[model samples]
Target: MIFTRFTLKWGKRHWALVTCLLLVCCLVMPQWASAHAYIVKASPGENEILVAAPERLTLEFNESLQTAFYDIKITGPDGNQADDGNVHVDADRPHILETGLQAGLGNGTYAVNWKAVSADGHPIQGAYVFHIGEPSGSPAGLSDLTSGSGSTGGPLKWIVSLTDWIQYLGLSVILGTLAFLLLRIAPTSMTREPMDVPGSYRLLWISYAAASFAALVSLPLNTLYESGVALNELSWRLIGSALKLTSFGQIWMLQILIVMLLAVTILSGYDRDRSIRARIWSSYGSLVLVLGWLFTHAMTGHPAAADQRALAIAMDFIHLIGAAFWIGALTAMAICLPPLADKLPSKVRGEVYWVAIRRFTAWGIGAVAALVATGIYSSLIILPAPVLTSLFTTAYGLVLIGKIVLLIVMLVFAWRHARLARAATGSRLSGSLKAELATGAVILALAAVLTHLSPGQPAAAGPYQETKTTDDGSAITLQVSPNVTGENQFEVDVKHADGSIVNDLEQITLSLTHLDMDMGIYEITIPKNDTGVYKAEDYISMPGRWNIKVHLLTKTLDALDAEFEIDTTKP
Candidate 1:
């Protein structure tokens, strides 16, 4: 009600200004947007036959991407690199990426292998061919280079998810404990100090320590998450480069500052009655630290990609603060406040409980409103009208739905607790508060996964996906590309029965069958290849796993069929 009144008093002009700012962000904010990042257009173009080779290669995408991760390796007709300099993002345009080409070349064909990560934090990659004079053969190394690009799969995603949950959970405890001490216990205590409840200090310390530890572990974990690399074989070069060059690196470095400041703020105790100015100044300083933390968080997540740059960030900040206060305060109430209250005289219990309840409920109402509003706003940003159906259809949507369900359950408990707080002298939300915290953990985990999920927006390009090798020995390498439902490119690298490269083959045919549906056999033409490599392009109308049979024929050997499955997970 207070927030509502404030908004109304601020007038329609302020709201209009907010709208205009959002419009700017939506149209011009390069830092804050994309559902999925992909190459929108390329200089040479995909599978183009050009009379002359381009002097420079430029790639444009739908999203602003970190150039640190954008790698370009152009192999010419002679199986050698065609480019001279490192790829760089266009100074004026963040989405436009370019690399200068090495000249003096007689080209047959060239393959551009690219890998880039969106600012919103999705990996994308592709391999495309362009002919300078005439097509000779498929570029050999490229097939392997682009094989498993753009996939956010494997165990690392889950590990990243776990780390994210810890960070948020720990934040909740810090905010909740600190708020409770400063607001409720400290005001009325004999010392009129923030540490009236010694248990509150302990709670704050544990949460602070846990959060700091999570932050330390998460840097490497986040780097691994971004690179989609295995822990044992993580590229130190990649981590080092990211730390030095990327926004994520900048955010991590800032987190270090925030951690130090937060520790200092907590250590500098407050005696409000003795020195209100110092206490007020310290609170202001803490606010700045909190804002910095929120800003850094937004820089790495959806808010960076949101259309209205400032508005989106504001929403993210409010959402975080609200959730942290509500969840953390409840946790502190259940853990720290109750025992302290028990130690107090029975005469004072009623007054303390009622007053604390009044203050918290007011805070809770505001927090709940902010969470609900921002959650909806963010959802709309991620999933627009037509594709909004994906809110139920996609895995991302399903997880969001689950989060909403848990929130609704907590809201119901909250309504009951509010009534109990007003009516009872000895307030007890013990069971309900615990339930809320438990539900909140799951909510944060779901959120961690949700942020990583592709919103399946129209702007999003197909998932860059791959399939595991069917066999170990001299087996065919099958790449099912742009791993979303649509026209998919299937490239088969023919390896002999003896695990040797079969560059000379008489006949190679590729056939497909829908594994999930009753759709029968469908075969596509195998393009001309002097090499044993078989390339096929066809429309895969729907998503899901589909079985493909690659039939190989030779003059000396009998026919052979290699099996692999294509998983078109989502668009």
Candidate 2:
């Protein structure tokens, strides 16, 4: 008796704690975008060096690109006027942005800094470095390379993350709860005589309101991310820009409307005696509306701009609904099922719980099967065959692997509980289901991060810009462009105290190291350019701080060494 009472008390307290942890994990962890405003492809690609400078710059995004709200700045060997100072968008290809390069450019390292606006008003910005002729010690404007990550601050990111977490949570609740009603409850509900499930309705309302609130707040949060403006300082102009110009805004508005319709249909269905035929049609209408709402999500993600988009969008739609039914239903079980079993008349208690558990087990099985199938399809098209190896090699791929492992674990728990129910674990099944919910909670949290990460593919895509000086007052400010876990360009700018470029350095070499894992040193020569800079192209296969040792051979000093560190950001 003491153990039972203790277990019950702990369960009651810990349940809320667990739920809060789920949301906290979703918010605090490094956020991965859900492919809302993802890049489809770039002209030179990340860390790619061209033998000759391209005539112009072109960028293609997954969603419609808005130039009016964009800031495309390029600073290379010659300082900021590398481009013709105009970004052009073709009427035929609003999704593509292009700008002409300045005439008579020489061979040197060039860094492209761009901030493009998605139709949803979110600004997607990044910097890429390419070698033109030969390497200068460092490009003229190499110090000016802006990676765009700094453009949006921590406050904006956290606010955006919080709202996004709420959105995901809300989506799980709305879709999963409604699914439990239509699929698990409604058909059998006819036979159960419709007892007053006050807790169930209350749970439904909370989900509806949470989802509605998240969807509503999503607009302002989108504005905050795009404009780099604080939530309070977000003017009507910015909000209007996001809603009118971005794909996310348009889709979000439509969702609010559908959410209202969904609430009406669900709330009305509570009345069991009110014309069963009408109720069926209303449920069917609500289901159709829910599918429509899900399409908006499909349209706004990586699929919207990806190759074979129709296939990707269809797969993503099914994937989300399946996930909602599975995770969301688990949430409903955590919130509603225990109370439901209690409300059943004593004579029918055990039988009703058994019927519901069996029914939900089948539902869970279908949802899992759907998730697996769609997940495979998404991986294939998004990452492509050439980049498949990057999954195990890159940070993004490692995170994806972690998510897959957790999913497998969650699946095991689901399978175990189904067996326990079949063995008639009775009230013990309640404890078992709660355990399953905890595992599933983590799976949902990881899912939120997966979308933002590089698909580890064609669009496969970091931050390292620092300046260091030597003893003789000669500055060897070396900048490693695109400090991602893949390809990168290293440029070392050797200049005198008078600020004149040093083109006559006898020899220059570099060493890259990651001390933590004992990931040894990678050394290479950074030869001098016609323009007096030293540079070389190499791929770094990890995401962390890299210790750089720059060795310079000069007449005054036999061997002058300058050391500095560059921090690479994981994609």
Candidate 3:
């Protein structure tokens, strides 16, 4: 009950602190957006004969890509790398790579291996083989070979990384400063007078707040740049449109709330005559900040769209809030502990600092537990199949592992810090604890980077999708695309034995049954314009064998029912 009471009272500080922290998180989210699926276009567009050797090999794609992980490999007819070396990104083209090709690649089959990030951050990779007609060992030389050459729009990436770094740093500073202020300024007991923090410490908050605002603004710009939008064309109209869209709605509200809270807090600090109201505004501002944290990442697409969107949203909310609290508490400890220790006699300082550590350690454990439990649940709910192998094979999955590792490291440092705090050593162990906090800073930074990694879905280890077509002198043709989404479109045409077919079937009922149970059904009617032909669109929920029944209305008052067995599983 005392722990709960203390948390409830002190928790208000976590609100603003977490809000600012979440804002920083938004800047890092594009790293995980959309799994980066993209296709890089090859030069010559499939069918161009060049009389003279081209000086360069070029590639284009529908979307801008992550330069950090993009790769391109070219193989000559003999299946050796044309350059026999890895292709590197050229400063010239941000998204493209330029590499030298081997001097002689005699005509044969040439292959291109490429992996690119899709506009949404998904990693898509594939290889394409092309034939070279001429048979000369003379290696075709390339003066330059890089994609995204003319548009090495890499500034956006750096901006994002920098903003993210500063954001976390700002979080540490803001929360740290506030914690110091609380420990110093708040009354020790009901009868005690409030002790104001020195003007110098207050000044530091000014810089921290400014940095926080700059990061907020930089996030939107960085997002646009990452999406390949031209800076010059990034007008208010586009921003307005984004704000109106659901994807950016949460972020927009978060930013607006952050601005309002900061303004109120600043005004409260300056109103000189309203110290009581100022404290109230500061408290409210902090709460708004926590809410802001909840909103900033409200839009990061994950756990899939609408599959279990509500649950995913809830987990994301909790994750951000817990992160904010943990970060804020650390920041508070760093700023307030030393000064408070110096103010009180060494003995009392030891008791107070140790008590604070006890409180924070409990908090950290609870937050970490929530993070893990919800994170795993969210992962399981979104993925087609949840398996450990996905961690190695998928970007998102791999990133999750990396984050877990960092979390463990952070816990170790926290544990060490807790031990020292409890020991209350006469030796100057505060600096060592500060060093531990610094380690926590590194963990948060790595957390920021891992935020961008995609959590790839576990590839279905199920059997291949099998499609069958039995052409028994029937006019019907069925085309099926086997994806897990369960959508299938088919056309059936009936013909007379004389080869003259009725123009259209009045009514056609198509039903799929499995072992006498009706699995799915569709009803379609054909117009007179298309004689004896009927078309139907339907989906089967899962992969299995089923009997397809087709009821056709013939030209007369007669009707015919035909049945076909279909095996839905395919390779």
Candidate 4:
């Protein structure tokens, strides 16, 4: 038997320095990430009063949308269907959704409720109202219209997170174990000898099966999530639609194919002759397949939606690989090392254990460095500047903080284990290794929840007011109370050149258009209030710069139009 000899001189001071660097990175890195798809503009805009009923309704999002499981419905004031039952995405513009409405609809408020799956596979839904001529009675409020949609805290969401956690765990183990075997174990073993760690191999097979099952099950769960359907409502048709029509489905299918190929490669190489060249090729093949599998996750995640998409995806992939090496290898060592050492001769046992631990420590340091650097870069790119200051308040930020805390704890355990490895004391190391693995599992759970959360913090609730002078020497002030997305009250006060209130207006119409995207104009009728103020409530839908044109019809039927630009923020 031939054993490889090497010297490793890492100590506590080095570990402390690394720990401080990680802490500094965490403190300085900006926080708060982005979110899934949202409505950027809508025709027959929320709470808008139209002179004539529209032939169709349209919605435009901030990002490209998936047609699979997309739904938009119009309900008339009488609670009957107002839409033509055919809703589809615009061919030329992937971000726009349009549906024909029943023609010649009577004067009343109509509801437009929409649900869609974003390109990144997250499901988002919203509801709004628009009136024809005049609003009769009150339509269902936004909250009431969205009441039936599943909340983010339900059993279904948790179940999906659980599946995600399991899949992550399984992948980590598979990749980490392979890395451990090829990079750490193989070089030390004789060329003719079979790497005979039955426990580790068994763990790998179990992980493979679990990961494969989780991946398969995730497809249907994703269908349920995207379609906004209950378990009982799930069908083959919906699943098939998701698979064929959605980016997530395509990526998932590719992942399954990779898994199949991975299975073949693993099985084919399992009992092959223990030649160095063959082992090297097999290891490289497995590593490449595993990386491809990991890439699918990055494609379906928040990074795919980022502005610097390619770089974001690459960073996310590197983060995943680093995590697999650190957490996965630790788990493998905890389970495989003790028993293997017990079976070896006393003198050789210490040497083997020392070699494994020393190699792992070296790799672990590199993995940790990669994780910290990529994590910081991803956070910076994913979150907007305004949101970074208030990171602790958002759910995503809190979860990420928890993950970081766990990572720091795991690092301490790793450092202790590395110190023990210097003495070649394999027996004393199992407890710390298990501790690190446990911490990693908790971190994975937090990560599962984090992935499902929107990193954008809700915009501050405050009225946005701006004053503009009309050509007729009148001062028109536009105030949007609670100028965040969703429901907001729009009030316009008109004053004559002498500062007297101008109250005798035939009608006040406000035309709103999103300046960031060409989503068409949204005309809203601002009715006169009891106090002589023209005010109405409507849904802003999204956050960005908006151009609002307020048209005033005097008692003599003369029209005056004034334009005002305002910025709305996320809700």
Of the candidates shown, which would achieve the greatest lDDT relative to the real structure?
4
lDDT against the true structure, each candidate: 0.66, 0.63, 0.49, 0.75
lDDT of 4 by residue, 423-508 (tens): 66543356666778889989888878867776653335468898888887898888998886676899988888899998888899
- Candidate 3 local Cα displacement, residue 131, angstroms: 18
- Report the C-alpha lDDT of model 1 over 132-241, residue by residue, as the tens digit: 88777766444533321244545777777777778788888777776776665232453335555647667777887887888788778777777756778577797787
TM-scores for the candidates? 0.71, 0.66, 0.50, 0.77
Instruction: Show where candidate 1 strays beyond 4 Å.
Output: 1-33, 76-79, 104-109, 133-137, 141-153, 185-192, 227-240, 270-284, 344-355, 384-387, 425-427, 457-571
Q: Rank the candidates by lDDT, best first.
A: 4, 1, 2, 3
lDDT of 3 by residue, 1-571 (tens): 1111122132656555545544543333222222333233556322233444334455555334445445567766554676546565545654565555566455554555555444333334544333456433222221122221112234565465466555655654554444434443222332122224334245336645755675567646644643346777776655554455323334556665676666566455444476664664564565456355444543443422324455556766676555655665666655555554565655555555555665666566666656655555555543323245556555456656766676676677777766765564452335556655665666556555544443433323332222222243334433344422244555666665455665655666666554322222333333334645455544443333456676666457566566666544311
TM-score of 2: 0.66
Q: Give the local distance difference test score of model 2.
A: 0.63
Write one digit per residue (lDDT tens) for candidate 2, span 166-231: 666666776666666666542245244222433556666786677678778878776777666555
Flag the better candidate by TM-score, 1 or 3: 1
Give the higher-TM-score candidate: 1 or 2: 1
- Local error of candidate 1 at 64, Å? 2.4
Off by over 4 Å in 4: 1-5, 9-33, 140-143, 146-153, 185-194, 272-280, 345-348, 423-426, 457-571
TM-score, cand. 4: 0.77
Clash pairs for candidate 4: none
Q: How many steric overlaps does candidate 1 have?
A: 8
